[model samples]
Structures are given as C-alpha cells and as structure tokens.
Target chain A: MDTNTLTGLKSAFQVAPSDELAKVICFALIESGEESEIALYLQQAQKTLDESESLKLAEALYQAELHETARNVLSEELLSHKILVAKCLNESGEPEQARKLYCSAIEADSSLESHALNRTFNVEVKVAQINNDDKPKLKVVEKMDLASVTDMVRYRQDTSDFSDVVGLEHIKKQISKKIIMPFQRPSLFQKFKKKVGGGVILYGPPGCGKTLLARATAGECKASFFNIEISDVLDMYIGESEQKLHTIFEKARSSTPCVLFFDEIEALAGKREHSRNSSSANVVSQFLTELDGFSQNNEGVLVLASTNVPWAVDAAFLRPGRFDRMFFVPPPDKVARKAILEHHIKGRPAESNIDFSSIASKATGYSGADLYNLVEMAADEAIDESIEAGNEVVISNQHFKNAIKEARSTTTEWLTTARNYARYANEGGRYDEVLSFLKKHGK
Target chain B: MQEHKYTMASECFHRGQIDRAIDLLRELLAEEPNSADCHGLLAGCLLEKKRLYAAEYELAIALNLEPQNALFYVLQARINLLRNKTKSALESCDEALQLEPEYLDAHLLKSDVYLVFNKYDEAKACIDIAANLQPGSVTVAHYYGEYFFAKGDIKTAEKYAVDSLSIDPQDEAANILMGKIKLRQGNLKEAEYHATFVIIQNPDSNSALRLFCDIKMRRNIILGGWWRFNAWMASLSNVQSSVVLISGYLVFMLAAQIFEDFEYLTVSSLISFAWIGLVIYSWVGIPMYYKRLRKELERFSFNPEF
Candidate 1:
C-alpha cells in the first residue's frame, strides 16, 4: 500500500509468481490511478509469471478500471498478458490499441484467422421480433413447406399410375408409422415410445418395387408431393444452385405435411467421398443441410427418402436422427412370386390347365415388377402363337414353360449389390435378411 | 548499441511494427515541440493499428498541416468502424465516401463501420457497393458471414464463415466468428480450441479472450482461475498455465505462512502476490473486484435470448 512496501514487493517478487499477480497489480494501478508507478512495476514484473498469476493479471487489466494501463501491461509479450491488455484497451476507448493487439494476436500466431468476427448479435437479422401490436399479420402460406423438403427430388414418374403397387402390408404399415402417423399427431410420439424421423432407404434389385414403395409412401402421406429430381435443382450458375435449394426448401416447408420422394438417391445423396470436385461437394452439403435444416417449426412434412444406392449419402446424415430406417427390398421369395403371379393373372383368360402355383414356385429370385414382366412376355408369346394359328386363346402352362426358358432376371448384379448392402458393407447392408438370403444362396 | 546477429529478427516487421512505432511516437510527442511529420506518422500508425482515439489526435494535428488529404478522413472512418466507435467513425467514413464515392477501401470501411455499429442494412448496402467495386472479394464474403452471424442463422452463418475462410484462411475475424458459433452450439471444447489459436496469434486479443472465457465457463467441472494447478495436481493435468500460476502462488503463500519463522516462503508468496497486483492494479485489489464480475460472464451460456 505504501511506497516502501511497493518497492519491497518489486524487489522481492519481480518475476510473476503467477500472471494473475500482474493482473492484480494492473488493477491496483487503475484503482490507485497511479499510471506511471504501475507502468514501472509492470516493467519490473517477471515475464515467466505462472499461469494463474498471469490469468489474474489479465483479468485485472481486462476490467473497466485498469483498462487504460492494461494496454501498456500487454506489452509484456506473454500471450495471456497481451490478451488481457487488448481487452483492457478495448474497454478504455483505445480501440486502435485493441485492434493493434488483435493484429499482434495475428502477428503472434501463423494460424489464427478472423471469421465472421463481425458475426452480429446472432446473424443477419432481417426482421426483428415484433410485439403483438408491432407484428404485422403474416400470410401463413397454406400451400407448401419447402424447409421440410430436399432441394433435389428425384423426379422420374408422376405416380398417378402409382396405385399399381400391392402386397407388403407390414411395409405399408411402416410407411404409416414412419411418415403418416408422425404427421397426423406429431405430439403423440414419445421417447421410448418416441420416433426419431429417419431418412428411409429402399434398397432392392432394380425391378423389386423400390420406386413403387416410395410412391405408395408418398401417396399415403397425402401431403403435397413433390418429386424433385437432381436435375431440377443443380445448375451451373454460382448462386443459382443455392437459390434453387432455398426455393425448394421454402416451398416444401410452406406445404406442411408434405412428402418428397427422391428416387435414385445416388444421383444426389451419394457419399461425398467420390466427389473430387468442389461443386459436387457443395451440392451434397447444401442438399444435406436442406433436408435436415427443419427447425422446431417444421411440423407436417415427412421426408420419404429412397435410394437404390443407399450407401452414397454422407456419413453425417446417417448419424442418429437424420436417416435411421432402411428397408431391404429384395427379390420376391416363392410366396411373393405366387402373390405376384396371382395379381398379374387377375383378368387374363387363363384356363385351369395353367398350374400357376408350380409356375410361382419355379420363379425364385423374381421381384414383383420382374414377375409381372415375365408373365407379360409369356403372354406375348402365346398371343403370337394364337395369331399364327388364327384363334383366340389363353397362355397355356406349356407355353409359359417355353417362355421361361427364354426369360432371365436382370437382377443378378443388383442382387450382389443388395447382398453387399444387406451385409452392412456400406451400412446399407446391415439387414439380417440379406445375410440369411446369402447364407441360403451363397455370396 | 548492441551488435545485431539476427538483422531480420531485429527489423521492425515485414508488414511493419506500426503499433510499436506509434507507441514510440506517442512517447516522443512529449519532447517534440512541433513536428507535423511525426504527428502524421503517428496518426498513420494509429490508424493502421485501429486505435482511433490516438489516431484522431494525430489526424487533428495532421489536418491542420494538410487539409486536403481525403485518405486521412477515410482512414479515420476505417478506424471508427473497425474500432466499434460509430458516430465519429460513420461521420468520417461518410465524409470520405462523399469526397470520393469510388474509393474502394473507403466504401468497404464504411460498410465495416456500419457492421460494427449493428446497422446491418446500411452495412449490407455499403457492402453491395463494395461488391460492385470488387466482385467476390474476401472482404464481402467476410462481412457476409458477419451479417449472417449477427442475424442468428448459424447454419448459414457457418456457411458464409466457411466461404470467407476458404478465400483467406488467415482472416482472423472469420475464424473468431466461426469460433463464436461453435461456442453457442454447446461445443466449448471447439470454441476453446479455436480461441486458443486466436489468442496465441495476438496475446493481446480482447475478442479471443472474451470468447475463451465464455467457453471455459461452459465446462462440466472446475479448472483454471484461483485453485487452478498445484504440485500434486499438475502431475495429472496438462494445462501448464494452471500448473505454473494458480498453484505456484498459493503454494508459495502457504509455504511462507507455514514457515513464517524461516520467513523466505512468506516473503516470497507476498512478493508473488504483489508482483501480480502491480502488473494489474499498481498494488490495488482491482483484479479481485473484476473477478466477481467475470464470474458473471463465465456463467453466461448461450440461451439465444442473450
């Protein structure tokens, strides 16, 4: 407190016991208004002040009172001391000093960067929160909710003919659980009894009804359905792609309870690993954010995401809540084949001699779509035969037997991929069905 | 007086040690009775450092010498915005813009001034002109993040921040901005991580420390500050600062108290505490009072409302 005591302390404890001591001394000067004396003591104080003392010193210098002296104190070159001085200078209306210290901070390290240092209170706030009276009536767009939709909706078909898909009642029930019920009464889903909206992946061989399943899922949601293809959003313009993404999400969010079906997910949701170019990476990143960016307000929209290449989405998206549910759309087993055969033969003039059950049993590995085509090809052959014989007729069992010889499933490669996926090779293959199917048939 | 072995190291700087030079100039201002060039140099240095008060002092002295220098007002405005001083910075920037509307840096500086003032629309407008002046410049991208972060869209805030960083990875403001967002998102480890880098760059970094203190406060347990490190605890923890300061002083004091008859440890601890006090407050308990206040800041979590 006295000059003699100050002198003794300066001589006795010159180097910082801790940086905090320096901070305390700076505070002492500010409170005492003894700038010259404080400066002298600061000069005499030790450089290797231990961390605590340095922090204390920094704190003192940083406070409003000692702020002016803190600038001089910061000259000590100790990183902690310097930071303290900069802050003190900033408080003491020495912004120039503060900025210099900030620059010095830049000068101190080769790596430190200043980003959005100008990042405001939160960000680019366009509209301020208005009180009830100050708030203008919002035109609550009852049409579309784009924030809930991905910018890239895989657009292939209108799905008006989408009603053709049948069978898989449980999968349909899953669609209701996964998309419909969640939208109808979102408040009912509880933890334990909770549902984390996950991205849905329909992985199956090409003709195995992946698209059909997606369509039914979309239709069942009964929300505004937008089938945004990859090409619909991505463009060459620098800002255009972002705008398109913005518009798509904006539109989707407005249409709450909307179902956006993305077919051939690999076209857009493909893993960032294979994308060597920045544009593709941008597309993926923007697309990922759009899909997952639903703030707490997005109530009605449920994304019915499907991908043949389920392995391609970014790893970040697959973490926890993004897209958790994946279904394995495999080739029809004998039972499914029989059901498919029964459905396809509904209006056909088949005689009792056809023996369709035996036909279905023979058609293992045939997907529903593939089975329908197989039967159609068989019918075509019969019609061709009848035309030559100059008679109206049914496709006989013998004719189908002949047709079966010419028919080959286009799903061999698809089965291998599906098998790999089902095995959890890319995480797309984590299903037990693929392992069992492969165990029975061999990888 | 000493022979210089490392001339390069001895040299002021490649970019120049403007602040140190300004400090020397301020010191010289006491002795020099009338030196306009010195004042101008000091102003220039202060302006370069973004220290507007000192810079303005020099500017007033310099304007008396040469009234037609448009760059001085421009620099003043730049200082104003960058320094968080609005009225003067804006007025100065406006004068600069009016004199030479096409002046690119001046325009950018005006936007910067507005941005610092939280006048986002004006800042954005200024940036619009600057963008027209220099399309896709890092400055525009930089402020783009700034405005967005201020607006509260962290996703886009991060997006623009990333964009700005991509252009100039060394941009300190962008990095700090990114670190702030990281801090707000409940990732103190990352916030501390980034702040550490920023702090290291400028030990005198007010912004970095502000961010760092905030991050440290968000932690799950006790560390740093008073009971930071001790001989026994230092063995377990790697934060060398704690190992050295918080523990070292207390140990010295306890030893001094315990061995008062011997007297060395007590005297040593007293001296250690005094040294810190002098460095901070000239032997006053200024750091103590601030500690109580800082405790409040340390408690500030990202409630979004704040």
Candidate 2:
C-alpha cells in the first residue's frame, strides 16, 4: 500500500496482465491514494471486461467501495449488470432507475428476491397495505349520483402527531385547541351547540411543512384523513368540477371525524374577479356552497386547506364561518431549524462533532426542505470520500459550512411575493401574520 | 419452491410495477399469511410505495411473527428514518444490533441516524463495527467515501471513490462522488464528463442529471450569454440573428443621436422609445427561447448529438 509498491503495481497492471493481477494492482493503487491514476486505469480496464466479467468486476468494485465505477462498468442492455447497477443506483438516490435495474436483475436471476433493495417499491407496497388491496383500486364513481359521494374521497389512516413534526410549537398548540380539541371533546362542544366542523387555512412559504402540520392535526384528533387532489376535482367539462367538489364535501361529512385536507387550495378557490372564464367562478361558488353545508351536518369534519398565496383565494372563503382560523406556517425558527436539521439528518452518517445549533443559527431563512437539502449536500460530500478511502468517512462541520455557502434559501422569492400582498392588498388586516413574519425576518 | 414467485414479485417491484408486485405478494401471503418472510417482503414493498401506515401494519405483523428477527427492526428503523423520526430510528437500529451484534446493515443505519443528530462519535462507532463485520462490503466502502466527502477531504474522498469504482465502475454513488470531487477540484470538464456519462446510462439518476445541469450553468456563465446563445443557434447555421440584433441596436442609437443633433427632440424621443421596445423584446424573447429549449430537452427527445 506504500507509494513505491503502488507505482510498481500500476506499472505491472499497465503491462499485459491477468484479471487477478489487475485487480490486485488496482486495489493497491486505490490504497496508496493514487486516485486519478487509478480512475484512468479503471476506465481503461472497463473496455476489456465482457458482459459477465463486467458484472463480476462491478460486484468486486462494489465490494471495494467504488459505487460510481461499479455503475459505469455495466453495459446498458446486459441483464446481469442491471442488479449490480441497480444497487448502486438506489444508494445514489436514483431510485427510479434502481427500480428498473432491480426488475432487470430479477429477470436475469430468479434467486435475488429481496424487495428491500428498492425504496420506491417499498413505498408503493406500504400504500397497498394501507388501502387493503393488492392494487390501488380507484373508487368507481357512478357518473353524477347523489349517493356516490364516498367515491370521490380517498380516506387514509395517518399516524403523524405533534411529536412527528419539527418545531412550530405555537402553531401546533393553536391548531390543537381550535381544531383538534373539538374532535377530542365532541360531547362538551355539542352541549354548547359548537359543531366541530369549520374550515381553517394554513398559509405560508412553500416547503415550510403546511401539509405535514395538517396531517399531524388529524393524527392528533385520531380522525380519518382525506387528501383532496385539486386535479381530481377539477374536470374540464362543465358542472363536473363543481359536482366533484360537492361530492368531496359530502364524503367528508359521511366519513365523520375526518380531516379533509385541500393542498394548494388557491388553485381550487382562486379569486373570482381575477378569473378570465366563468367556470372557475362557478367552481368557487360551489366550493362556498359546500363549505356552507346547508343541508348536511358537518359536525365532525375538519376542512384544512393550505396555500402559499393566501391573498389570491376568494374573500368569501376567509369570512367568519369558512376558513376563519388562519394560521401562518412561517419558516423554521432557531429551535425549529435545529430540530429540522436533526429531522433531516436522521439515519445519515455524519461526524459526531457537527454543531447542529451553529448550522441552525446560521440558516435563518431556510425552510424545512432547505435544511433537508443542506444535510443531503453535506452527506454527498462525505459519501464521495468514504468511497475513495474504502471506509466510512464522517460528515464534518466544515462540510455543512461548505454546503451552506452553496445552498440558497427558496423563501426569498416567497417573501418577495408575499410582501406585495401584505403591503398593497391587506384588506381587513388579513395579511397581518405575513406582514409580521416579514417584519420579524427584517425583510 | 416459492423463491421463483418471490423473484417474480421482486422483478415486478423493480420494474416500477408496484401494483403487480403487490398482487403477486398478496397471493403469496394468502397462501402463507403466517410466514414472516412474506410479511416482511410485503412490508418492504409497501414501504417503497410510501404506504407508511400499511407498511407499519405489515411490519408489526412480521415482527410479531418473528420477535427475534433483527432484519425486521432494521426495516422498522428504515421506515422511522423516512418518517423523520430520528430518535426512534436510532432506537430501532440499536435494538437490531442488540439482537444480532454482527448486523452490519443495522450498524450502518445506526451510524447514519447518529450522523443526523450530529452525534458523530456514535456514528463513527457504528461504521467501525460495520467495517469490522464486513471488511470488503461495498456498502461499507461507499459509506467510507461518503464520510470523507462530508468531511471536505476531496482528495482523500476521490481516492476512496476511485477505489470503489475499481471494484464496481457502475456504482452510481461512487460516480456521483467522483463527479463532485471533480467539481471541487475545479475540473469542470471531468465533472461534466462523469455526469453526462451517468445521465446517458441512467436518465433517472436525478443527482447526475442535476450535476450535469450545474456544470452546464457554470460553463454557460463563463461562456457568456451572447456566446452561449450563438453556440446554440449555430446549430441552425445562423449567425445572422446576433449580427442583426447588434446592428439594429447600433443603428437605433446612431439615429437617436442624429435626431438630437438636428434638434428634433420629439423624433429623438420616439426613436429612443422604439429602441427600448426592441431591447425589451429581446430580453423577453431570449428567455422564452431558452425555456422552449429546456422543455424540449425535458421530453428526453433531444439527441445528445445536437
């Protein structure tokens, strides 16, 4: 593993050499820290590796901790190389390709039956288990029927609670008391004629965990979760979109003790005045009608909608009885940022000395997703070294500092857009939370 | 006897055929619902599909079926990791290690969780245990490269990554690591070459794709917008666009100055306005042109040859 021996091995490998000799020479060059030369030699060696030899070579390199080289050595159409490449792909966050390679692997070898290798499939399998079906059976809706409301709503059992969420203590407490408490103390609320169902809108910068909070709220209340996709409700045909919205509301009512979450709610309920067409206007009207729930009891249904552009939503949706409780999900505070960093770093190997608090303090404008990406960037840096050394390298504080320099907070764009609404269009002091957040951040 | 069916199910799972895999697994489960392996496989598949609640249910069943299994705990830890429950993930990994002291995967995962907490000592301890358990494991070697890369030792990281590639040249993580190391070393061409090669091999390698894009942007800035645009337009054998644009702007400026010299203030102002309009149009139109090109590229229909 010394320099002289490594140089000799490199020379030996350069001459007419056997595969065994080449492997030893390559490994020695790697151990001796001649990376550039080794990479060049390996690239040259790849041309000589046949389909089967390539698989063996890939497997050997994989064992030696050279993941990228393992992936590169494979021929695209070769089935045997797919499994080797797929494993490498999964480790690299290219799960989509990893999945395909795994499938190819299975076709080539009936022995490698472990599904644990592919993360994407595992997610789907979990989905299948949740729905209690072998396949994701889309509910068959009889076209425009009064009794087929449940068909439009997909119910999921969520286990997320306040513990699962990072930071946002104030928002969590507020939501718990106003929304979750009603479900928790239903009989007491009923005695006061206070129905549990009403709408609340969570507006904030994107990637700040609005959807996460909504699910946690439902989980805390132990309510059935129904996530309404806007596309699913918005039909191109006339009256269909409205009918879908109506049906969704009706389904939420029937599936009482339900948290009906409308993600990106602005899309479904944008301002009617700004609409260039009548259909969107009608859809908004239908949404309002459903929120009113004139003929039905919405007692246990909690309508939770989230939007980054709260100012764009129709004014009616913000009125006293509908979406009345507006909570702004701001970017993570210092404590939240530290917690967010911890949350993202979960199960990733890093040096023990990384100062999370320092990173958190420095990352002022970063959202939850921003912090996650920061950790990922740092992890990538460590992974590269780990592969080279043939040993696990630690993610250091310096890696994080470097990553921070490269990573830009996406919140700047959201804040710029929100400032316009808060300053020029603060009708009835609706954007006070946004204005406060902007001020607090020294914007 | 059931290995073939399991393989088929795995194949289905790998092919992005989640529903098909689920169906096959369900059938296998029906035949032997009590089999811990079946439950574990089903749970794994569910986890891949992001059915956390269901995956948890299946995991619980699998764990109940085999209370002593360390793999179950590892899978549970993985699920917890996805859920962002770092403490629980670590605890699960710990439990897995306690059950089977030599469980390298569990150790690796535990190290990862510790790293997330910035408990680097604990993370390294786990990695050390894993290395001892399986000295030549690709997973271990990859983690070694990752650790060094994270520590900002690009030279050492490249060494480890190259070592890994020597073993398996097709290793995606190693390639990405090398691409990153190349970038850090200011070898933009090398980085681009690695990323471009990876993208060709696996279009779904988003990291490689991103790296490739990053290289392009960096190169573009150095190349300058005018030159980059010219280079792109050169495909159409058209240098006329740039020539005309530059000539038109110069002519407008000359005309505005001439009008000012003649004391035709209104005409000069009018000419200035027209000049401004043309500048504005180019500003808007250039971005639109790039956007269209990007959209076409995203379709994966654009040839690399172009």
Candidate 3:
C-alpha cells in the first residue's frame, strides 16, 4: 500500500503489506502514546524474529523500546548480537563484565576476528604504538619506560649548555665529580661504578634551584634523558597503572645507558599507605615495582626523581642505595646572591646607586624565587613612576628599596618543613649554613 | 577417535599426541589384525616409537599381509636401518626402489643410512634421486644441503639450505644449518636470532640445542660484560635452567683448572647455561615464535596445494 492507504488504515485496526508497515506502526504508537500496545506489538515481532532467526525484526523491536524482548530475540548464534551486547555493556559502564563476555564470545567462535577486542584489551593499541625492535614491547606504557629514561639520562649527561648555569659552580663541580663523572667515565671509579643504580631524588623548596640542579646534573651526564610528566605517568584503571609501570621499565631497557626523570616526582611516588586515591596508590605500587626491576632485572639505568615535598614521598624511595644521595639545592647565599643578581643584570643598564653587593647582603632571608619577585617588583615600580616623565627609567637604590617593601616572601612555611626534611635526610647538616638560616625564620 | 602421541621421543619428532593415536590404533590393530592400512600404520608407528624388535615382526606381518605394497618395504628399510643392520636395510631400500622409483622418503632414508655406512657415492646418488623426485620437499633438500655443506661447497650448501627453508620454515635442521652458515660468515646477530628462533620453536630439540647454545655463548664472548649480565638475568627463570647454569659454571671452573682459554670459556659456559634458563623462562612468554612454529606445523598438515 502507498501513503494514502496507510493513512486511511491508521484510523482503524488494519494491517498492510509494505516496507513502511513497521515505520507506520512505530510512528502511530509514538503519536498516540499507546506505549502498552506498542510494547505488545514489539514483543510479538521479537518472538517472530527469534523463531525465524531474523535480525531485521529484532532491530525494529529494539528501536521500539521492547529491550527485554529484543535482547532475547538477538541472543543466539550470531556474532553481530554478541558485538551488540558488548556495546550495551560497555556503554552501561560494565566494561569488565563486557570484557568477560567479549573474551567468551571470541572463544565461543574461534573465527571472531575483531579489532574492538584489541582496543578494549589495550594490547594491540599499545603494540601499534611500540617503537622498539620489530616486536615493540608494551612495557613502555609501564612507569619506567624508555621515554622517561632517555629524558633523565640525556639530561644528566648534559653539561655543555649548563656548563655555565651561572652561580652554583662549586656545587655543580661537586655533582659532576660525584654523579656526572661516575656515569660518564665508568672506569674512573671502577670499584664504585654502579650497575643499574638504585636512584636519587632532589628535595628542596620551589626555585631554590632544585630543578636547575637536577637538570644541570642531567646535562653533565653522558646519557639520554626521559622527562615523564604526571599526566602521562598515570591512568584511570585498576590494573592500568601496573601495566604502565611494566611498560615504562621495558621502554627504559630499550634505551639503556639513560636516565628516567620524574620531575615533581611525588605525584606517583607518594607514600603508598598515605595515598588517598586507590588509583594513586596503584601507580605508586607500579613505580616501586619498576624501581625494584631497576636493580634486579636492570643495569646501567638510573632513576632520578625531584620533589618539593620530600616528606610526603614514599619511605621506600629513600631507603639506602635508593636515592642514595638527596641534595638540597639551597637558596643562594650573599656571595651566590651577588653572583645571581650580577648574572641577571649583566646586559642591563645600571647606575652608581645600584649596589648589588649591598643588595645581596640585605636580601639575607630571601630564596631564589623571592629574589626574582623582588627584581620584578622593583623594575615595575621604577618604570611606573620614573617613566611618566617620558624618559627611559633607570634601576636605582630607591627602586630596589620600594620593591623590597612591596614584595613578601611566601616560602616561610615551606622553608621550615624543607629544613626539617634536610635534617632528617642528612642529619649532619651537610647543608649546615643553609639549614640554619632556613630554621631561624621558617614555620 | 584420534590418539595423541606424547612420548618423549615421539613428541620430539613432531608426532604430537600420536602416541595415544598409536595406542588406539594398536587396540584396533589387534581387533582387525589383517586390515591393510591398520597393519601398515601399526608397523610405521612401532618403527617411529623405536621398538625395533616389535617393528621388525610387525613389518614382516604387514609384508606378508600385502606383498605388493611398496610402502611396506619402505617401512621394513626404515626399521632395519634404525636397528643398524645396514646390509638388510640397503636390501630393503633396494626392494622399495624396485617397487616404486618415485618414493622419495625411501630414497631419502636410504641416503641417510648409506651415509652412516660411509657409502658416499651411493648416498650422493640416492640423495640426488630423492631431490630430483620432490624438489619441493625440505627433507630431501636438507640432505643435499648437508652433502654440499660437508664437501665445502658453501655456495651450493647455502642455496640448498635457503631452498629447504623456503619450503619449510619450521624445519629445525634447515634453520640450524643456515644458522651455522650465517655464524661462519660472521653475522653474529643474524645467526643468534636464527639459532634462538630454532631453540624457541623447539626447546626440546636435541639437534638444534647445541647450535643454539653455541650462538648464545658466542654472544657473551663478543658482546662483553653487560651482555653476560643480561644473559644471566634471562636464565634465572626456573629450576631446570638454574641446574643447567650452575652445572655449566661448575664445568667451566673444571675446564678453567686445565685450559688456558679457561677465563673466557668458563664465562661463555656460564652464560650459555644462563641462556638455557633464560630460554626456558622466556620460552613460553616469547609469544609468536613457537606459536608461529605451531602454525607452520598446522600448515604442513593443511597442505593447501593439495
């Protein structure tokens, strides 16, 4: 029948032969709000589909919201329905159960060739992304992969550009002798040269030059570097963290003679028991496991982590040989401060009143970050008032004084805690003067 | 009903679950003792199982049951050969040749047995005949490759080995023979990979085991200290591996007491042993290698050309 007959039949109880019959009935039921009648018709259609093994009828019934009937009708002897069930479960947030059904479906029919199964399992997706020898291992997804290792190792080996990281010459030389030289020239200290070292974590307040020192060490070392960010280090799954951890180590192994850098590293390296989120704890477990692999199943690989909150980090990370060395990238001293100030002002115009020697001495309690803030504040103040006369402002003592008055150091609480951690970390005050100054005014 | 072959020897020869199949056939053979196929298969199974005495009587019965069949004489030749009765084996081989000149398996077996008896001319002739009959057969090509390889015709040997592998990738002999060719050519990485592939595909392969172990030993010697550590890590997988490695160490230490090459040899032995353990531990986990071997075996049975 055409549209006219179908329209005419709509007012009475009539059946017609046409491709639009199901569509007409569906629209009528929806328009009349006769849900109960619609449901009955769907159930009957589903039964017929089941009896006849017709996918068309089941699909139509499913569209009609007779889900219960539709589910039964499409439940057997077809891979299409199996895939549909998996889709429904996945959409409903039952992926684990869906994975179970998907695996069973694959097993039930050996010929079930599926790419979705590969994605759901995460096996093939990782394999395709693998950049290793022929068989690119999935282990790079682990917490200790080659990307992070290369970042850390290459960074550790770099001293060319940071050869003049400005002020920490003695400290830089010390790191070079202790860490950099040892890695670069393994035969120099043959007896002490480590194989697949435990690791090291840098702990200090923000801008105390902790990151700079870490980078300086990386730059000086003769290895590849891998800088792993927190976002890339974690995942939103129960076992994904463990898998990622495994992948990380595998990746690291691929690019050996390298370092794995975890900057602001405590994100996943936090104390497991204290980890508030289960996902965070899982990631921590993966990290620790990867660390263990570093020494046991690993060699020539170094794990370098830097953290501001050293106290919040996992206790396991600090045990002997693991982070065997924790250095404090202390805030610059008067001499160091003068050097840093001079380095910043080298190319700038300075007058007779701009006494860096006095400025360095007076800025006794300021950290490196505080000094930068002071500089910025003073520059703005000088420009704001002095340049109103339409002349280029020159930095002077008055500007420094006014800026010092305006800039407040925000590292008090942090300095106090960091000092305590240093005492606990090295106890002997290897950084005695820095610790003493920090303790005097810290929280 | 399919019987599974699983005896240590049978399984090693790729007769998967064929022992159970043999046992089932044995019972069926007892029930229908005169059945031609049953008698023939029982004799073949018995010969494969290395029950030489029983195989002798069984083949005799099969021959009596069907004198005209050439396959029966081939079975008799193989069994006689396994028993070291070279003259009888040669006679059976001759009888088989008379019945069917195109029987490559018989000709191939005769060449191998003749080679064992130091009948080089006869062996070469037989091998050449088998190769001409089935140019695509890896087994025949392998024998020809072996002859040329022994005669120092490295070019001819290499070509034949390549030909054998092209026909059958999972042939342990072909893979191992090519591995040696690559080893002598100083292609250590390629050689090691090929040898390692052989061992991984067939861990219990007695023939390929020495070559595989040799390649691993060579790696440690050439690759240096870090590699020895890597091989050690690989070997720490399980008990069997631990025993072999530890024993290899003890053996190396003993050799060290007597040999000037002790230091290097001992380290090599330790690494090789470690390699075994590593191979054992990692064998199952080294996905695709053995699975591909299994697929290859499946392909052999699945003869799409037929």
lDDT string, candidate 3, A338-387, tens digits = 77776666665556568888877777656677887777777787678776
Give the Å error, residue A280, model 2: 2.5
Q: Write the per-residue lDDT of candidate 2 for residues A11-103, one digit (tens) a residue.
A: 776676656666566556556554444456665566565677667666766766778877887765776566777778777778887777677
Worst 10 residues of 1 chain A by lDDT: A117-126
* Alpha-carbon runs more than 4 Å astray in model 2: A1-152, B1-306
Please give the TM-score that candidate 3 achieves against the real structure: 0.37
Best by TM-score: 2
lDDT tens per residue, model 1, B152-238: 878888787777665544456766887898887887765665565555445445677667656655673253332222212222324
Candidates ranked, most accurate by DockQ first: 2, 1, 3
| Candidate 1 lDDT score at position B228 | 26
lDDT of 1 at B218: 64
- For each of the candidates, give the backbone clash count: 98, 80, 55
**DockQ of all candidates, in order?**
0.01, 0.01, 0.00
Please state the Cα-based DockQ of model 2 relative to the true two-chain complex: 0.01
Best by lDDT: 2
Better of 2 and 3 by DockQ: 2
Positional deviation of residue B253's Cα in model 2 after best superposition, in angstroms: 21
